[model samples]
Each structure stands twice: as structure tokens, then as C-alpha cells.
Target chain A: MNIERYDRQTILKEFGMEAQLKLQAAKVLVVGAGGLGVPVLTYLNAMGVGTLGIVDNDMVSLSNLHRQVLYSETDVNKSKVVTAAQKLKEQNSETDIISLETYLTPENALRIIADYDMVIDASDNFPTRYLVNDACVILNKPFVYGALHSFEGQVSVFNFEGGPTYRCLFPEMPKADEVPNCNENGVLGIVPGIIGNFQALEAVKMITGIGEVLNGKLLLFDGLFNSFQKIRFSLNPENSKIKALQDSYDFNCEVSVNSITSDDFLQLLAENEIQLIDVRTPKEFEKNSMSFAKNIPLSQLEERQDEIIFEVPVYLVCQSGVRSKKAVNKLKEARANAELINVDGGMNEILKHAIKY
Target chain B: MEILLFGIAKDIVGRSSFRFEEGDEVPKSVLELKQKLNNSFPDFGKLSSLAIAVNSEYAQDGKSLQRGDEIAVIPPVSGG
Candidate 1:
């Protein structure tokens, strides 16, 4: 490590030559290339964190340019990781940048994260977050979590040796609708910038072995009021109960949970009072069945709408409530008169509740 | 009774640590306490949809609160 390159940072009492060397030797994997990931990757690369892995499956959209400062107008429609990796490599050729142009599925999670010393959760979805946390816990690696919504941001370190885990803070995940993403609810541009900067600081701190890391505490920040607070939580023993989560099983489980419950909606079908529409794949319908439902999957719902009579309430059922709700919302939006009722518990929950039905 | 506070509620109350009566409930309904605290202190009125947890466990809507509970009035949680 050349002393001149980090002269400004080296002179600081806390971060000296040894800290720079630690940063140079550190290998970090950032899980997203949007919003928070941009600033985090930038600062980490600028500080010379030796090898950086950027993971993302999305392409830059016009809307992404607002907070994803890494991409330019010309880079729209380009793979996020590719563009991000290129830009970051240009910042400092000495810092090696590798891009994974795909989503972080559970199958590849451990493999991708195994090589990195520390991981950062900058992804935007619950499944990804849970997957990342579980993978981190299993790997026994410290993961710095950062998320921004509206004007608020949260930062925490999960599975840090004996520290509290994400499950300790939130034992069970909420319904997807309980929290909306930035694309749906919107967020301040600077919110991620601030949160991402904090993530970079935490990463640097973790690497250099300086400062009190956010081990067992969760830090929340409010941009509107400029306030900060730290809440402490203890590790939950039950987190270990989720011993192993395979890719297929987890994906199916998530989809099933999101699906409408059969018990709640099947009663209507058992009495022949309402019409049930199976908006799932033919294979899904073959595997599961409602008492009296038509096999018009969502792919064909639009063209085959005439096949089902409009005399009764059309109860929509899919693998999860997501597609069914979307179908109902779309039907309502199109001014369709058939009564639209979306079963809350999708097919998976429904079957669990009403196995005989 | 002394109950330590954290998150946005601490800032609203003006101090991170404070004392209050245990009240009637073992874990008092956060809504009722929020109203009383706002009426008495008047500043916490702006905090709404804030989650309440006692001793680090999320509290039920009408549960009674006890003394020494680590009361945290969390702003909308945005953690990943």
C-alpha cells in the first residue's frame, strides 16, 4: 500500500497505514447495484477495498437514474451489475470489480458470498433479505444491512459472531403488502445516499477493526427530523431452527404463503355459491384442486374470460395472492362488472387450512 | 417506574431515559400511553404508526406495560 495514495486518510489518528492495508486485503460482496449500493460501492472502491463483487439482475431503467447515481442516461437498459462494475473499476483499477449479472437466488447465494469476508444487503425485497441473512448466518459472516423507505433508513449488522441476528429483531416476516418498495411508495433520493454512506462506514469499520460495530443494535435514522436512535435486541435461539433453506423449497414456500387460503375461499366453492378461477399454471392446478373451479390460468384469463359465466362472484385463486390481486385490480380497473373477490390466503395457505376441500 | 426509551420516541420525549408510573396494564396499550404522554408532554403528538415494544418484544395492542420494560416507539421499520 502506497502511503501517498491514502495520505489524507492515513494522517487521521484512527485510520493509519495498517487500516489501509486491511482495506486493500478485504474482499466484499455488495448485493445490489441500485440506490444504496451505488454510494456503498463508490465509497468502498474509492477507499480501496481490494476485490468487490456487484450482484444484480436488473437493467437500469429511466426511473433508476434518480437515486442510482452510478448509471448515466446512455447506460439505461444496461445490466446494472455490468455498468456498475465498469464504472467502479474505472474509479480505481487497483480495486478488482466482478459482476454477477443475476439475482441472488438461495442456490447461488452461499457460493457467491462464500468468497467474500463481509457482505452488504442492499437488495430491495424481503425474500432476498431473508435469503441473504440466512446465508450469512449459515456462513457465519457479518452482513451490514441497509434499507431506505420514504424518509427513513435502518442499518444493522446480523450474524456477527455471537451478536443478535435479523431474526432476533423480526422473528417473522410480514405480508409483502405490509411494506411497499421504493418503486411503489417512493423514497427521497438522499435517503439511500445517507444510509449507503453509513453502510460504507460500517464496512470500513468492520474491515479495519476500529470503532464499535453495530453488533447487537439496530440504528434508525429519520431524514425529515435529522434524528438518530439505536435499539438493542438479543439473539433468538429459534433463528437456528431454520437450519437449512434450499432454493426450490424456499421459493415454493414463499409462493404458497403468498397464495390465497383455500379454507377461506373454498367454502364458497363447496356450496357452489361462487365461481373459482384457477389462475395458476396447469401443473399447479393438476397438483392442487379446489372443489369447483375452472382451470383458466392467468396467462389465458383475458382471452377466456367469456368461458366462465358472470352470474356468480368470481373468486380468483393463484399460487399466491399477488397475481390474483393483480388480476382483480386489473378487472376492476377495466370496469368489469363481475364481482371480484381476491382470496387473502392464496392456494398454498388455502390447501393447508382446507386439505379435504 | 423507570423505562428506558429508544428510537424516535426517545427524541420526542426529550430524553433517552425517564421515569413514569407503571400504569394499570402490565404492558399498557401503546395508543393510550401515547395519548397521555402527548397530553402531558405535548411534543409526542406527531409520532403515529410508531411500533411499541416492551423488553424488546413487540407489544400487543391492548397489553399492559410493566416497569423496567425497554419501551421503544419505533418509527416505521425500514431495515432489510
Candidate 2:
């Protein structure tokens, strides 16, 4: 092993040569190679975590450059795990890096996660997050959880040291569509960096047994206000009682990925059978909206929901796709018992297709 | 009272902090505070749960809010 490469951390009394060896023997899997995965890979590789597996199906895109720091302009259009693996291998010759250039599906999650001692959940989507959590629970491996939205980031460790699992903290999944993701709400670039650092620290602490790991607790960081709060939680026990892994459900249908193109949306409108629910604010609907659409702003949706006529399927539209997604989730939560799909691009799609302002 | 919003709560309210004037609706209990937030931003109800913290400690629904307590709304985050 290259002792000089890890001289800084090994010199500490808690993390001497013995701890270095422990890191050398550890294997960790990091899901998603986007904003959070960048920092996680950098730290674990630099710290000489023995065998690291990187799994990501996404390719480097121009939009990812802001937060996914590991990739450069030249690396765009290439496989993320491949590019990340090459860079990580160069950073530390003593550490072994494996690149799994595929998405973590239920078919592959168990097989891939079974080989690692610990898993770092850097996934940006809900379905994958739940999948990782459930898989970790069944496998009996502790996983570090990190999530960032807007200016806030949350960090926690699930199924570690007989502590609470993710399900214990979050029992039911949020109606897939209502959850506002960074793609639409927008994010401050540094937020994920801060949260990802916390995730990496948790992993190092867990492996070295040096400091307190977030067990049955969550650390919330708000970059805008510059405050940190730790929230404690008790295990639900029922959430942790997963006897077996279930079938993998597709995120698009189960969650909020149901999007119909402007042309198709207009075609459906012409049929006049389906109900059109405008989820935008009253001002937005007044400014521009379909002629047959009912203007039920998202904020006032529940109070005015009787207009929905639950027996029929509903199509939702907003300024952008985000609000419409939220409207679908709201309807689902109310158990309206009807199919709700968002207009693919919302008003943006209509404007693009020139279907009418 | 100023409620510090984090995660998706900020997105729903479109701000980092929400201030309540003396005359403005001052919710005495955590549940009332949440109901007030929901009245303002109906999307708040969409989240599975919003953990509240007062003076850096987790506050229960029945916990009373003081005049100048540090309150934070921790909404669930899924972004990486």
C-alpha cells in the first residue's frame, strides 16, 4: 500500500495504519453519478476505500457540468461510470475501482449491492431511493442516505448498527408526482456539494468507527440560512420488517412521469370526453389556457375538487410540467380514483407546437 | 414568528423564511402552525411529513411556539 498517499488521515490517533487497512478491506457501492456521486467518489477514492463500485446509466450532459464536478467538457457524451472510474483510478492507485455502466434496476440492484459492504445512496429519484433502501434492509448492509433540494440538503444513515431504516423514517412514499425534483424547482449548485460531503463523512466514520454516525437521526442543512438541525426518530419496526424483495415497479407510471405531448394533448381536448384540469395559478390561467379547460389552481385544488368529477380520467396542465405533476399527486392522495396524467410540456409544449395560446 | 423553510418547503413557499407579524396569524401549537402553512401553501400537504425544529430540537405537534423561537420546517428531500 502507498503509505505516503494517506499520510494525512493515517497520522491521526483514531485513524492510524490499522484504520487505513480497514478502509483497504472495505467495499462501497455508490448509486447515481450525478451531483452527489461526484463528491462521494472523490472522497472514498482519496481515502483509499478498498473496492469501490460506481453504477450509473446516465451519460455526461452539458447541464450536469455545474454540480457533477468530476466530468469535464471533453468527458461529455461519454458513459458516466466509465469516465468516473478512469478519474478515480488515477487519483489513487492503491484503491480498486469498478464501473458498472448500467442503471440500478430491481433485476440488478440486489446482485450489485450484495457484493459491497456499504452502499451510498446518491440517487436523485424516489423509486431508486426506495429500491436501494429496501435492498439494503434485506441484505443487512448499512447504507448512507443523502438528498439535496433547492438550498437544503439532508443526510442520514439507514440500517446501520441496528438503527432505524429509511422506511422507519419515511413510511409511505410521497405521491410520486407531488415531489418537486431539482430539474424543475432549480437548485443552488453548492447545496449538493455540502450534502454530498456529509454523506462521505458518514461513510468514513462508519468504516473507521471513529466518530458518531447518524443513526436514527437526520441532519438537515439549509445553505440559504446557514443552519444545521439534527432530528431524532424512533424505528417503526413494521417498516423494517421486509421479509422479501418485491417486483420492481416502473417509475414513469407509478410516480409522475406520465407526460403526453402537446399534439396528443390537443387531440384529446378535441375529443371533448376527457376532463382538462389547469393546475396553474388563476393569474397564469387567465393569461393563457385551453378554452375547454377548468381553471382550478393547484393551491385551491382540494377545495374546488368537486368539479373534477372523479368518475372520469383527468388531464392536468400548468405553466411547466412540475405543477401539473404536483396536481396529479394531490388528486392521487385524495384517492380521487381516476387516472391523472400531466401534459408533457404543459403550456410550454402548447406554445412550442403552436396549438393556441 | 419566522419559520425557516428547508428542502421542498422552500420551493412550495418560494422563500427561505416566512415571517408572522404580531397581528398576523400566530399559531400557538405545532399543528396549528402547519395548518397555517398549508392554508398559505396548499402544496405543504403533499409532503409525507414536515419535521419541525424549535431552538434546534425536534418539536412535536402539541409543542407550543414561543414569541422568538427558532423554527425550521424540514421537508423531505430526494435530490442527490
Whole-model lDDT per candidate = 0.73, 0.82
| Per-residue error (Å), model 2, residue A291 | 26
Tens digit per residue, CA lDDT, model 1, B7-50 = 34555566656666546443356667666776866645544345
The alpha-carbon deviation from the true structure for residue A346 of candidate 1, after best TM-score superposition, in angstroms, is: 19
**TM of chain B vs. native, candidate 2:** 0.91
lDDT for model 2, on a 0 to 1 scale?
Answer: 0.82
lDDT of 1 by residue, A63-91 (tens): 67888888999997677898888898788
lDDT, model 1, position B65:
61
DockQ for each numbered candidate: 0.17, 0.46
In candidate 2, the residue pairs with backbone N, CA or C atoms under 3 Å apart (3 or more residues apart, or in different chains) clash, namely: none
What is the TM-score of each predicted model, taking all chains together? 0.67, 0.75
Tens-digit per-residue lDDT, A126-244, candidate 2: 77888898899889999999998877788999999788888765665565556666764567887888888899899998998888999888888878678877878767678777867
* Native interface contact recovery, all models: 0.17, 0.67
Residue-level lDDT tens digits of model 2 in B1-80 = 88888777777888788788778768898999999988988988877757787776666689998778778887667787
Worst 10 residues of 1 chain A by lDDT: A249-258
**How far out, in Å, is residue A161 in model 2?**
1.0
Give lDDT: candidate 2, residue A49.
Answer: 93
Could you give the CAPRI-style class of model 1? incorrect
TM-score winner: 2
